[model samples]
Target: DAGITQSPRYKITETGRQVTLMCHQTWSHSYMFWYRQDLGHGLRLIYYSAAADITDKGEVPDGYVVSRSKTENFPLTLESATRSQTSVYFCASSTSGRLGYFGPGTRLTVT
Candidate 1:
């Protein structure tokens, strides 16, 4: 439960402003990912990284950016926050791409 925790638990930003959500995992799983949870949409992958410096786009990558410079850290950034981007974001880590351990989740609101 405490293996991963996201910062700023909640945030509110204006449209066109930039925002970044930070995720840190103490377990150091090889694969880390960013996902957004919204009403009706469920959870959608925004991006994922297999290892340090190796990242790939996921189901929804537009308007978002991610970087993994270290195995335990993966940060997701919104290039320009939009109303549609407001949602609860989660960070998860997995060793083999199957089961994953998730963070506490960060609630982001863009007005």
Candidate 2:
């Protein structure tokens, strides 16, 4: 889903070193997504999953990973952290192809 292509791209929320951000939605939406927000680049898609155990790569999936094992939970993991990976991550869910809701962002900064 090339969803909500034009929303506020600024970050809302941080982690240093190996970090994992978790997102949980009570609405039981089938689609979940992960994005990273940076000052100049805005929000870049990192990964998304249509359902539990189903996932896909997005624009900037490199160095990032995601998993969905339950309908309400989506977790993002950053491997071998690098300074370039520093950014605020956002998690979102939607029933249709467009994004409907966004979780509070989690910041990750690799030193």
lDDT (Cα atoms) of all candidates against the true structure:
0.93, 0.76
Per-residue lDDT of 20-73 in model 2, one digit per residue for the tens?
677887787899899888999988999999999999999999888888889888
Clashes of 1: 0
Minimum summed lDDT over a 10-residue window in model 2 is located at 4-13
Q: What TM-score does each of the candidates earn?
A: 0.95, 0.80
**lDDT tens digits, residue span 1-111, model 1:** 449889989999999999999999988799999999999999999999999999999999999998898999999999999999999999999899468999989999999
Task: List the candidate 1 regions with Cα displacement exceeding 4 Å.
Answer: none
Which candidate number maximizes TM-score?
1
For candidate 1, what is the TM-score? 0.95
Q: How many angstroms is residue 52 displaced in model 1 relative to the true structure, after the best TM-score fit? A: 0.4
